[model samples]
Target: MKTDLNIINICLSDTPMQEFIRENRILGRIISAIPEIPFEKVKIGECIRKGREDLLYENKKTGAKHTKITIEEKCVYVSKVLKKVAEEHNSDFLILDGFLHYFNGAYWEKIDESVASDCISMAAEKAGFLPVEAQQENNKKKLLRQFIADYKCPPIQTKDDDLSISVNLRNGTLKYNNGEFTLRDFQKEDMLRYQLSFDYDPDATCPQFDEFLDYVLPEKQAQDVLMEMIGYCFIPTRKLKLERSMMLYGEGANGKGVIYELVKEILGKEHVTGFSMAALSFDANTRAQLSGKLLNYSSELGGKCNPDMIKKLISGEDVEVKTLYKDVWTMQDYTCKFMFNTNSLPKETEANVAFFRRWIILPFDVTIAKEKRDKKLPDKLKKELSGIFNRVISGIKRLLEREDFTESELVNRTLEEYKIRSNTVLFWVKKEGWFAVVPPENTERKSAKVPHVELDFLYEKYVAFCKKKGMHETSNATFNERIRKLFYVQTGSTNNATWVFCDKPKEKDIPVSDDTQSPKSYVERFIDNLNEEK
Candidate 1:
């Protein structure tokens, strides 16, 4: 009898047969040719006996001996079945760092190994690759391993330039260049493995974020600087050549912490890593966490840090990182930017032009009063993430066009203050009035024979001051160099390296017996005078 293939297609396209037919399209045609058995009675993987004229069906699960299909046929069928699954999911069976990842429309997301294995098993069974009889369990395990080995692709490596200027949003990828933002559909070729938790909406407005910024950074120029700095963080490439790290510094409950929270929210928590300056400097494990992060920040930055490490991080140099239970690897073109929120500057840092040039210090001076604090401000800002993201995009455009961060009066002053505070010798000199500003040549003080002090006497005073303040004093040679850089006083080779043109304090302020006074009392008196002047 002639078989009706159309009727078989309709029958198999319904209920349980639908899933099997979807996975193995060829099985539907072969099964439809058997006219003796009703379509509803046929099950996937059923054995068929081909007699002289007719065909007989027997369920493989009902202890029926096998009839026609061979193991080779099943293997081919399973391969085709899995290939379809991979195509539909848009996956190349890619692996990265020993983890399986699949494309989910917007970006590639990690898939658990167990979940992948289960999926393979189910698809194989639907494609009529199920095990039979007492060896069923063993057969299933063997089939799973075989399929996994067949489909697994080699691990892929990511380049730093791959993430440059492109941000994966929930809806699509946003690419920025010059002063324009172009949104496009996500492409598999982009190889983006991560995405922001929020969608990009250009029309969104963030009044709460604006208010927060205005409150924290009152100056328009300061706000512009902050916006530009944050915008720079979004770009994962250091091609702009702006090798500077940011520090938000103050003592009170200023809005520095709130800014950090907002940035964390905008960038998504997964893309930002929290590593203290010290940890990033000395801890290999912490550096490992920074491999794919866009920003690395520390809220409580204090004490001394390795200036060389800081320079390397901000300069986008290749850094050596070691993960737990893994071999050390070099992270090429490390692009993570640094931002620190500290109550005080580090005790000691390299005092030089290159070191200080690598830092951008923004002072947080406005402290919120207890009665005027907004308890729910952060949550309110959270609702404005989309709007804030747009603002960051705008800032990024401005930064790219200018090719630098905004330089303002407040920024310069804050940086200078931080430099002085970070250098103990400079701070001591500025605080103690140890050297006076040289007056004009025609001034009365200039012609008073320029009261000179021996270099040895000045060194003794500096040592005494350092001892009283519990600060480390620089060596005599270093002291002389720093003093020359800090003050305008002329050093004369005569009289055993005399510091000439140094004006003495008013006669009334001088001690009756300067040689008899202790260094501690002198420091106390100087401090008192400084406070009075303030």
Candidate 2:
């Protein structure tokens, strides 16, 4: 008996690709300019199989058991099986004309990557189009695929389990797993891209960021302006901490958490860590619970705390934790990127010379008047976007599989997915607004007016650490403490203050109580002496 091969295509139509539509709405306009590939409705026998027979197969070549058979029962289940077989046979053509089994509920188990890939390829091939992957040679970066294969998140078992929703900024479409919807405003994409890059590399070309925003905010200027405000972090500059730590303040609807979610999404959910600024001053348990878990966070946190503790903690100072349990933990140190959502930044904390010197405050006022939202996803663009998602997931998976990717490299690669650059990181120093430069302590803050304030301190600390054969700047907190201490000593405070800065803002000088200026500034003198010896 000749075995008949059955083909089933599962396409979610009329279900509203809410996220995809919102994004590629503009792309839809572009697509509309071009003629659509006509689709015809046809009917055929639906072969639904799931039983012991479906689970068993004999290998054609070896005459051995091919026990890894897929059982197809439900519409999605049957479609999935057909998809796999189509892929195994390298079927290049696929057509979905009529009732392709409507998804009764919103969330269903995702079809395997191979199935999605095969579907995308099949659809394109049938339309006489080449797969995007085939068009780009450099995209052969197999590491992305490997990464996704090895990657696992705290299982997102259900839609309710999804704590956040992300709009593809490129297209202005909402995305959650395979489900997508269209939206009205391009700014949502901008805000989301801002949110994602706000913590990671906020400076430039997040292809993922671009992919998200391209369809939504096509205006180069608008996207550029928004990105400038959100991109760039204070990694380290000249051996000193750059004053680039962030504090985003706005009302509830203003899109504060949106930035954090974007970062979380691209960072593979497992590698990216987040902390609520409020949780920093809350008890250790809360801090650990909020920061440690991959996704779940207490919604109660947004209202409970002020920004002062966050201010102090960012400056590398300690704060007391108010514990729910009787046992209290002194949770002061913070190294990971922090995202806080609140009505306003603490005023006094914002005004502090040290805090101001260290912090980069980006105000996300959603109420500020802007252009109206854009909404309209054409069928053709929706089809294209669905293809993009498949490629991106594939690319990322390939990146994760490479041998060259270290833990740090992998982290950076993940950030790139959202358009966050990892080459140089930005942090808020509590003294300045957001900056793109690396850790100043590591680089000797070129922008600092105070001479030798950063370097003199690093030198002294390094000497002491070497004498004891111990590294003092082990953690972000410890590294920051040394910098703040240097600022205090150089500026000459009467008591041990948490932070200090030079009195003269205009001059590149930090003066002590000596009242008169020295012949050579500390930084200048040190550099001169070192050069002379060399």
Candidate 3:
């Protein structure tokens, strides 16, 4: 309900640069969706702050210390400012555009964090709605999604007894008696959300990935990985919990450019942003200019070596210049889904979490490509990709409606179908269920005799771990045994056991088969089939 309300109330807050940021295709697309909310872009005061320090000496012989005023003045020049620009446009949320900074990646040290949080919190408190932190909000979203999925709500409209309208929020598809709804009058936001699913492979080397790689060296594996990386751009509005930024990696000449090209292709010319860190080092004026626009767009900018600049850009809080231009620019704040393709070092430190969460890291590999192509992406591949993209969005929508699964669990379960993990089976079993690690059948594999989660040993061990970490105490609902699908080691018994295994079961864990065989193999088989089809 709160999310729905937020969706309805989406509008721009009083932050400068909001318009320019929103005008970007990605942000614009999100704003265009969710028509219930009004949005407007205010013409902002363009403040250009110049930082220059001149060391003056009164008397060279006297050797006296001189006062140096670090005068970095920000002159706010108004240009046809619009009041509450975001709200006027009927948007469901405000999109702020700003920069943040971190040192060695430890904590959020932004000039605007406190002020922005205070303002938003105060407003939310007055409105009896607290602004949700990303972590907390994720939990809430997960729970709500699960609730909605299982909820058997009556149709909003029912015509004949044989026909009713059921809509899947994931794909924004309406079903009339289980049939696709013919277009009558459609809303733009819903369609965009449905269309703009983010599900590409930064390492794909196929048409989906190779679409961009065609310009670079061509190889099948590289193309496939690239395709996977690029596919993620469109899944967010469908509620896919994707990382906002990406890190494309591989050796040199490995089609890294190809992967990045995929990003440029879908984000459109206007939305794809670049940053140039060297520009700031060039001069004071250059540093000032780089402050407002997207940094990743600069042709000269490369990710691996520009940690400081990237950190500054993402945090939207504080940026420091060490040279003659020791300018402290307080950036505007906003939520942006940042995508970065790099060869190495993608993790953000504690200090950069605010900015870190805004990014979804993607890696690229050129050497893995199987073939080289010089032409544009084939029409057939594009068509396949279009369908796959839609399916991915729909899958995410369904995923969001499930229980508030842990982020790890979400990753494990969602990626299970992708075969992204080679050695593990994502396992969910009740305590009373047969075994924790069920080895495959007829392969000289036997199920380990691990006790259920409620057993004395595991329960005590887990409780101790939770206590040591000061985590919340578990309740009956929290006893489900959820495990990532990873490659397991063969234990003494017929079956191989894995560390970090769970024996608990939740209400949703379904039981199967009269025989003593573990249901895991069946589950794996189903997933394998699905992957084969893909």
For each candidate in turn, the TM-score is: 0.68, 0.26, 0.29
Candidate order (TM-score): 1, 3, 2
Look at candidate 3 and tell me the lDDT of residue 72: 12
> What tens digits encode model 3's per-residue C-alpha lDDT throughout 1-534?
998788756632423433443454433433233222111111111111222113332447886434332111100001001112222433222111232211111111222333323332222222222224211334334322332232223123222343322222223333332222332222322312122222333233344533444445343433333333343333332233333344444455555554355445444334345644445423334444333222233333343334455554444434443323334443332222334444443222211323333433333333544565434543334434444443333333333444122233323342452232211112222223334343333234334453322233444554565566444334322332222222122334323323322333444455633542354564555456444541
C-alpha positional error of residue 48 in candidate 3 after TM-score superposition, expressed in Å:
43
| Candidate 2 wrong stretches, greater than 4 Å | 1-240, 250-260, 268-276, 289-308, 315-334, 348-350, 365-534
Write down the lDDT of every candidate, Cα atoms only.
0.64, 0.32, 0.34
lDDT of 1 by residue, 102-121 (tens): 56566666555545444444
In model 2, state the lDDT of residue 342: 49
Evaluate model 2: give its TM-score. 0.26
Please tell me which predicted candidate would have the highest lDDT against the true structure: 1
* Model 2: per-residue Cα lDDT over 52-73, one tens digit each: 4454555789975444311111
